[model samples]
Target: MFRTFVSGLILLLPLIITLAVVAWLGQFIIDYVGPSSIVGHALTTIGFSFSASQIVAYVIGLIVFLAVVYLLGLAVESRLRSHLSQFLDSTMRRIPVIGNLYDLIQRFVALMDKNDVEGLKSMSPVWCFFGGLDGAATLALLPTPEPIMVGDKAYHAVLVPSAPLPVGGCLIYVPAEWVQQADVGVDKLVSIYVSMGVTSPLKIPPLPGPGPRKGNLTAT
Candidate 1:
């Protein structure tokens, strides 16, 4: 019986959550705009009181909600977006630890925007092989296009972003040969990490065996 109940609950959870959300939307509208509030009283003047003004009010509320969201979307595409983003950046950067966090998030958000990854010109997705050419590979981002010369050996700085967050991680310096070009975009890479690898990337391309391919050692 317990097993049956658990299985049943699992099957019904999605529907239950959907209905709960819809009911909450209805109640919120009734409380603020449509039926119980002044807007509800105004709606009554238009004979909107079906089912004691609840169902009709909820419909109106849903329409209003969609309109507000559409307007916000339009605003995001306008000049106001740049000003608002700059204001947010300056304001958020004043809050110490949170400011640092906001900067990280802001950079990632820019990466996700198809039209605005200019801020990440120095970064690119890569597969970092550990130990040697045939070693374990990791998904990472090159912090800079050029390799740093560390005592005659060239080392690349790669940032290994944390999974499910991708906002913070550790940076490591490795040989140029350890890094390979990953045929993935910033947004797709972020999505894969945020989903904890449940959303896998495309098939890995053929890599050189054992050591660096003579002409392919540069980080793209």
Candidate 2:
């Protein structure tokens, strides 16, 4: 009975959680722009009375945001995007609670857009030690005109994210000689990490050995 209940929960939990999140987000937006809010007053003054059906307005706002993003992506040089991104980043940084979150998100976005495996090829790994134990190591590149004490070290960096969620992790200085290039790609690495040992490309079972010879099998 316990097993059956657990199995049912496993099947239903994702659907339940998804609906709950959707409901919460919808209510949050309604509260943010409802009749008593500043946006509500402005819209009302403009002869547009807000209603519960204005959820469609929220969807339209999302569509407009996506459309603007698409248009920005189509720009030839990305100069416009850079300027807009900088402006947004600056504004986000001014918001107290959201500033730190935005900065972390920005860093990840910049890394994904700008960094490549080849760029990581010449980098090395920096080992972090704690309580006489090796905690973690990250591949990274360093900047040039290297510090005199660290004069010979290469100039480049790569952040090595922790398991489960690769979004947050330590930043370390990696030398050019330390990082070992792998045949597996980043997408595969992400899958391996997210699945938390349940999935692995390397776990393919070996083919069974050839059957015993006919003469040897005859005795059996």
- On a 0 to 100 scale, what is the lDDT of residue 206 in model 1? 71
Q: Give the per-residue lDDT of model 2 (tens digit) for 60-152.
A: 554555687688777625657558766887999999989988866664544344344432332222222222123333322221212222475
Candidate 1 lDDT tens digits, 28-147 = 666877555776565554444343466665566556667877997798899788887788789999998999878766765666667775655546888888987678988898756677
Q: Rate the local accuracy (lDDT) of all candidates.
A: 0.73, 0.48
Candidate 1 at 185: error in angstroms?
1.8
Pairs of residues clashing in candidate 2:
124-174, 124-175, 140-157, 140-158, 141-156, 141-157, 142-155, 142-156, 143-155
Clashing pairs in 1: 34-40
Model 2 scores a C-alpha lDDT of: 0.48
Q: Which stretches of candidate 2 lie over 4 Å from their true place?
A: 1-52, 76-105, 114-130, 133-163, 169-192, 197-220
